[model samples]
Target: MFSKILVANRGEIAIRVFRACREMGIATVAVYSETDRDALHPKMADEAYNLGDGPAADNYLNIEKILQVAKESGAEAIHPGYGFLAENAPFARACDEAGVVFIGPPASAIDAMGSKTRARELMKEAGVPIVPGTTEAVDTVEDAMRIAKDEIGFPVAVKASGGGGGKGFRVALTEDELQGAFEGASREGEKFFSDPTVYLERYLPNPRHVEVQVLADKHGNVIHLGERDCSIQRRHQKVIEEAPAPEWVVDEETRERIGKIGVDAAKAVDYVGAGTIEGLFSSDTNEYFFLEMNTRVQVEHCVTEMVTGIDIVKQGIKAAAGEELDYQQEDVVLRGHAIECRINAENAARNFAPAPGKVGSYKEPTGPGVRVDSGLEAGGEVSPMYDPMVSKLIVWDADREQATKRMIRALDEYLIEGLTTLIPFHKTLLQTEEWAKGDTCKELLEDKEWLKSTAPAEAPKPVVEDEDEETAESKYLVEVSGKRFDVRVVGPALSAGVVAAPANGAAPAAGGGRKPKRGERKGGAAGGPDLVESPLQGNMWKVLVEQGQSVEEGQLICIIEAMKMENEITAPKAGVVEELHVKEGEPIQTGAPIAKIVAAAAE
Candidate 1:
C-alpha cells in the first residue's frame, strides 16, 4: 500500500477520498484553490498545498502545478476525484510521465473512452451493444441533419465527444432544431472540454439511465458490483440514484447479462481501477444500449458501495499499486438497496436556480441506515465558483420500500439554514406514488406546477383586528429565541413587543435577540426603462439581443452559466432593448438588472 497520495479534487469528493485513504492507513494530501482555502477537505487532510489564486482553470485543472505539488509533497500517487481532471487522459499520462501513479484506469483506457464517438466504435468492435448512430464525429450541421433525418431518423441526440453531466448534450426532435442543437453541443463541448467535435445518437426519450459499477486490477481481473438506476434527472443531469435498480425493471437475468457486458467492456480496454458502464435501458422494449463509460469513480458510487459492501476507492488505489483482485465474481453479492439524493444548493421553485451563500446553521441528519457525505459545516460557505452539490444524502435498508421511507425521514431532519436547498423538493419527490412505485419522476420534473409545488407552503398571516376589548382575534403562532410559542395577543397588529422569524432562518446567528439585517430596497435609477433583472449570480455567457432590437414577450435576452448549468434570461414583455447594463463574460448578481427594456413604440 502507498504511504501517501495527493487528492487532486475538492469538496465532498476530496473529503470522501481522504476518509478512504485514512482507513487504509495511507496519509492523504489535499490541494485547494484560493476560493477553497477554508474548505473542509483541506482542514481534514494530513497535508495541504495551495495551487495559486484563480478559477478552476488556473488552479484545479493546472496539471503542471498539481504535479509540482505532488512531487514536492512526496505523494506516491494522485487521485483525481470525479470532476475536473478525473477523466482527462492527458492528465493521467502526464502523471505517469512525472513518475507518479495516477489512481485510476490506464491512460490508454481513458483515451479510448475519452471521446464518445471513439468509445462507440471501440464498443461496437468489441461486440458490445450500442445505440444506433454514426460511429464518427459529425463535422457540420448539414452532415448531422442528413444523419438524423435519413439514417437514424428524427429525435436524435447531439452529444459532445468528450462531454458528460449534460454539459455538451442537446436533443433535436426535428430538422428545424438540428442546426441549433448541433452548434450548441459543439460550442459547449469546446467551452467545457476543450473539444469542438460532436456525434449523433438515437435519442431515447423515455429510457432509464442505468449503469454498472466496474472494478478491475492491472492483472486483467475485472468484476462488476451490481448496477445503479439514475433515471430521475433534470436537464439530463442525475438528481437521484439507486443500486439494484428496482427488480421490476431489471431482473436477475438482465442484471447478470448487463454485469457481464460491463466486465467485457473493461477487459476490452484493459481498464484498471473503478469505472462505470452507463447504458440507456429502454422503457418500451426493456432492452439496454451502451451509452458511455465513465473512466473514474462516479458521484453515485456510494449507492453501489452500500449494497455490495465493497470499498471502491480503496480498490482503485490498490489496483493502481498493481494489486490483483481480492474477490472473484462469484463472491460478489448484492445485499440490500441503497438510494442517494444529491442535495444541491439550489431552489427548485425557480427552475432549480443556484442559491450559493454562507451556511449559517448546518445541521446534518444522523441515524441508523443514514449517511451524509458532505464537506460543509455551520460557518462554511458554498461558493458559486464550482459544482452546487452540497452533499450526497445516502440511505440504505433491507429493501427499497424501507430505503425510500428512511430517505424521507432523513431529509426532514437535515437543516441547512442559510441558502435555499432542494430538501423540500426531495421530500416531496420521495412521497409521490410514482416514486414509491419505483417509477422515475421524469413526468413530475417536467410539470411546472409540480416543480413549484415542491416549495414548502408558508403559514398564513394573522388577520388584523382592532385593539378594543374582546376583539375577534385569531391566535398567531410565532418563533421567539429559536423556540416556538403560542402568544395570545388581543389583536393581530404588532404593538410594542413582537418578533418575527428572520428570513432563511438567519436570526439565530444574529445574537438570537435582534432583528435580522434588512435587504437593500430595489428601486433602480429614476429614468430607467423596465429593467430585466438577473435571476441569480453567474457569469453572463451570452447576450442574445442587441440594444434597440425589438423582442417579443418571453424572448431570449441572454444566458447565465452558473454551477455548471445554463439559465436563460428572457424578456418579461414585448419591448425594445434600450440599454445593456452588462456585457457578455461579466459576472452578475441576483436581482441586478442586466438590460433595460423600453416599450416597443417608445423612443
Candidate 2:
C-alpha cells in the first residue's frame, strides 16, 4: 500500500477518498484551490497543499500543479476522485511518466472508453448491444442534418464526443430545430471540453438508466458487483439511484446476464480498478443498449457498496498497486437493496436551480440502514465555484420497499436552513406511486403536474389594511429575547421581527427611532409587528407581497435567486406589509433586510 496518496479533487468526494485512505492506514494529501482554503476536505486530510487560484482552470484542473504537489509531498499515488481530472487519459499517462501511480484504470483503458464515439465502436466490436448511431463524430452541421434526415431519422440526439453529465447535448425533433441544435451542441462541447465534435443517436423517448459496476485487476480478472437503476433524473442529472434494481424490473436471471456483459466490457479494455458500464433500458421493448462507460468511481457508488459488501475505494487502490482480484464471479453476492438520494443545494420547485449560501443550521439524520456522506457543517459556506451537491443520503434495507420507506423517513429528518434544498422534491418522489412501484424512467421530470404539485402551497393572505388608522392604539409591539421593539400595522397581524444595532449601540424603534417598551409604541402609539429578513445572500427573484399588501403565516414572500436557481422565501408569520426593502432585480447579501410586515395590535 502507498504510504501517502494525493487526492486531486474537492468537496464530498475528496473527503470520501480521504476517509477511505485513513481507514487503510494510508496518509492523505489534499490539494485545494484558493476558494477552498477552508474547505472541509482540506481540514480532514493529514496534509493539504494549495494548488492555485479559485478557478478550476487555474487550480483543480491544473495538471502540472497537481503533479508538483504530489511529488513535493512524496505521495506514491494520486487519486482523482471523479469530475475534474478523474477520467483524463492524459493525466493518467502523465502519472506514468512521472513515476507516480494513478489510482484508477490504466491510461490505455481510459483512452479506450473515454470518448463516447470510440467507446461505442469498441463496445459494438466486442459484441455488446450498442445504441444505433454514428460511430464517429460528425464534423459539420450539414453532415449531422443529413444523417438525421436520412439515417438516424428525426427525434435524434446530438451529443458531444467528450460529454457526460448532460453537458453539450441537444435533441432535435424536426428539421428546423436541427441546425440550431447542432450549433448549440457544438458550441457547448467546444467551451466545456475544448472539442467541437458531436455525434447523432436515435433518441429513446422514455428509458431507464441502468449501470453495472465492475472491478478488474492487472491479471485480467474482472467481476461485476451489481446493477443500479438511476431512472429518476432532472436536467440530465441523476437525482436518485438504487441497487439490485427492483426485482420486478430486473430479476435474478437478467441481473446475471447484465453482470456478465459488464465484466466482458471491462475485460475488452483490460480495465483496472472501479468502473461503470451505463446503459439505457426501454421497457416498451425490454431492450437495453449500451450508453457509455464511466472510467472512474461514480457519484452513486454507495448503492453498489451496500449490496456487494465491498469497499470499492480500497479495491481501487489495491488494484492500482498491481494486486490480483480477490473475488471471482461466484464470490460476488447481492445482498439487500440500497438506495441513494443526492442532496444538492438547489430548489426543486424553481427549476432545480443551485442555491448556494452559508449553512445556518445543518443537521444530518442517522440510524439503522442510513448513511450520509457529507462535506458540510453548520456555518459552512457553500461556494458557487463548484457543483451544488452538498451531500448524499444513502439507505439500505432487506428489500426495495423498505429501502424506499427508510429513504423518505431519512429525508424528513434531514434539515438545512438558510438555503433551499431539494429535500421536498426528493420527499415527493419517494412517496409517488410510480417510484414506489419502480415504474419511473429518465423522463420522470417531464411530467408538469409532478413539478408543480411537489412544492409546498403558498401561504394565506393577511387581513385588510386601514390607511387612515394611524392611532397610538393601532401600533403593535414585539419582543425578541426580552428586547422590546415597536412596529406599525399596515394591513394585518405579523409576529416576526428583525433586530439591527444602531450606530451608537442604542436600539432602533419601530421606525428607526428610540426603542419602545412592551405594549408601548412611538409616543405610546399602537401598530402591527415586523417581517423577517433573509438569512442568506441571494437575489430576489419574485416579490410575493407588495407594499401595503397583507400576508399570512408561512407565506412565500419572494423567490430568492442564489447559486443559480430560485428559492422561495416565505413569511415567518402573519402580517401586513409595512415596508419593502428589496426589489426583483436587487441583489441582497447575507443578513440583509428584505422586508417588514406589521401585525395587528393585541386585543
Predicted structure with the largest TM-score when compared to the true one: 1
lDDT of candidates 1 onward, in order? 0.88, 0.82
State every prediction's TM-score relative to the real structure.
Answer: 0.88, 0.77
Summarize candidate 1's per-residue lDDT along 1-603 as a digit string, tens digits.
Answer: 799999999999999999999999999999999888878989999999888687899999999999999998999999999999999989999999999999998889999998899999999999999999988999999898887888999899999999999889999998899998999999999999999999999988888899999999978789999889999999899999999899999999999999998998999899999999999997568788999999999999999989988989989989999998777899889998999999998888788888887777778999999999998987787888998989999999999999999999999999877677888999999989999888878899988889999876652122222224222223456897998856443333334345444344444222323232333345554433498888799999998989889999999899999988889898988988888888899999877888888887744
Best by lDDT: 1
Which stretches of model 2 miss by more than 4 angstroms?
441-444, 456-603
Question: After superposing candidate 1, which stretches have Cα over 4 Å from the reference?
Answer: 458-529
Scored against the true structure, residue 430 in model 1 reaches a CA lDDT of: 92
Q: Scored by Cα lDDT, where does model 1 land?
A: 0.88
Q: What is the Cα-based lDDT of residue 307 in candidate 1?
A: 92
**Candidate 2 lDDT, 426-510, residue by residue in tens:** 8888887788788774345776666766664442121222433333213456787998756433333223363444434654456
